[model samples]
Target chain A: MSEDRIDIGGIADEYVLGLLDAIEARQVETDMESDPDLKAAIAASRDRFLPLDDTAEPTVIGDDLWTRIDAALPVQGAAPIDVSRLTANDNRPGGWRATALAAMAAAVILAVALSVNLMRTIEPLVVAVLVNEAGDIQAIVEDFGNEKAAVRLLADFTVPQGKTIEVWTLPSPERGPVSLGLIDDARSVRLDGPALPKPHDSQLYELTLEQAGGSPTGRPTGLILAKGFAKITR
Target chain B: MVTGAAPDDLTTALAACAKGDRTALRGIFDREAGRLVTIAERIVRRRDLAEEVVQESFIRIWTQAHQYQPDRGSARGWIYAIVRNRALNLLRDSKREYTVEDVELLRERDQVDHVMAAWHRLDRTSRLHDCLGALDDTKRRGILMAYIGGYSHGEIAGRLSIPLGTTKSWIRRGLSALRECMA
Candidate 1:
């Protein structure tokens, strides 16, 4: 890294200490990605200054704040299947029978509605939920057999005034993630599938906040707001 | 009194959060939300904006929990880093007018001194405490004002009535010395 000629340790310390200006901080972030030494220095400085956090007095959180945060979480089934909840299904008490029955009824109705309305044209073999850094489900991807994938937004997302959200995929075993395309909003869009391998189970799909148009480098060149792995349901 | 989860527990809770356990996240929130809000408030200087920063920080924590590597630092530190980064980003983006009346500026300096004194009382034994204690008042306050208050170099210089370059140099030198002393 060209920054090697500079004092990375001092820069990392200042960056972690929040002394760098916004523009300088952003530059450091960009540099850290390619400069392993700079990244390590940053990690070290973070640990060094960590104890100072103990100084702040705890300010009581408003009761409604958690409620707001909870509401923003990506709804279940929008991403990879949660592996932890999969086990211990048969051990629930008999009191859960009523809840189970109601859930099953709702699932059946929803399945029929989805098949009739959203999936009528293309059968989804694998579904992936793409979440932003906030864990908000920003988009959902349905892989129809072949290299084609249909992506739909789960929430109304406004592309920041001057920026666009770029989609990327890290196909299994690939050394680098490849760009899918640029999305303007939370609207359904078809990805014609880049020249990379077909989308497969366990592959990661991510949405990054990037400058308008897209990453000029043909790669993700911004903050990743959400990402999740593909899970084959069929 | 704010009682944090032990570093190990926080790490485990974050790991569980990465697994999509909402309750684990709530457990973390129940523990650190107050301290996080207070820190954000110190930086952003508005209760509502601080709350917004805390809310957004938790969401970022939940989504990026899987990316937290324990070997690098404490989970609590990682969480605070995210919160501080979010708060600072908001402060920078808002570009709020920084017109401080003379009286208001004096009041803020006193407030910072009060908080710094409180910190000294609570954390007397930490290596950072010792290293920071060793610095002169200007260097120490410059570093604290930047890290704790999220003041930019210009802001710190303005607050301290010093040249901007001097403020920057003091903070950089302070951090470098702190690192060396702690090491």
Candidate 2:
């Protein structure tokens, strides 16, 4: 990254052209503060195509588009979640609250190696976009609850690093994946049937290289540092 | 310093938004919805996905406006960044159809009206567009596709049908030239 080898001039061009590498783009961002010249260049290049932004024709979206969106919105005027009756204790957890709690429990298991592989002998199981590092989502973690996981994971573990595992119980492993939560690093973790089922019966629990924020995919589209089964807890 | 509203005006609006002012939020939305949608559509070509990206972007903006630190960047850049990042993710994560699909995208003849309207705005768009105009037509188009269409380097290359390396070089050099020119 020496100034000599790292050509700010070249990078600026690529960046404006939107063809710069991740590392190069990041470098430009860092250098921009001290390098006034670089900043000016970026602004100019950005302008070149700013107007083409609305290049697409005005899509005559069927009423359903807005209606669907409106319907999906958090009914802003819808009862306001009955806040009056909701005391700290009576706070009815949203559906996700339970899953988040379940994830925490799963995380705890990940921390301490107590494989629930045996649980697969029991009932069935279940499954956001995420970025790689550029702050964009790489994949999604599908949720499966009502379907009662139709799949199972049947594998043992042995990772190099105490890898953090994330289990994705996707509706269709063929499609995108869902992130249930994280598992402890280089350790064994199990999911129960009453628990979340892995996306496919042969769902994947992979160890990804993540910073604190976790992978954007909600699943590990990162280096498959290690992988194992979607076993159940007997 | 003199206009309908100063730069500070945008910041003030954001502050109000941060205070949970739904009205202020709407104002921000009203002002930027078209732009946001355009930006979102740029990144996520699919209209449905683009709309989703725009909606999510607004939700994030509403919730995260309080996190805005003008010192880092302007309210506008930060806002656009959110949508940009979201759109980028949508494009990369979800395998979208790269080619023109549906009659809507291919029915290009009619889109000229919309495109022209945007073009007229661009021609008149403040000092920024002037800076962009300084770039060569090819370089400008490449940059525009990226910024507006949300086309990745690869996509840009595909559309432009040029060597990937050349496209990358154009973007890099274009940015540098722009910064220099604008400065």
| Candidate 1 deviant stretches above 4 angstroms | A1-6, A75-234, B1-3, B96-111
Put down candidate 1 lDDT per residue, B5-116, tens digits, no spaces.
7888999998898888999999999999998888887876666557767877776677677777865467887888888888777666434212234224423645576447
- Per-residue lDDT, model 2, residue B90, is 47
Fraction of the reference Cα-Cα interface contacts (below 8 Å) that each candidate reproduces: 0.49, 0.15
Residue-by-residue lDDT tens digits, candidate 2, A50-122: 3344343344333333333332233222364432222221121121122333343444344222223323344
Tens-place lDDT per residue, model 2, B1-183, is 112224476678778766766666666665666656665664554454566566656655665566565553556655666666566654543332222332224323333344334545563555556766788877777766666544667766776789988987887777667656655
List DockQ, one per candidate, in order: 0.20, 0.15
Candidate 2, residue A188: Cα displacement in angstroms equals: 29
In candidate 2, position B77 carries an lDDT of 57
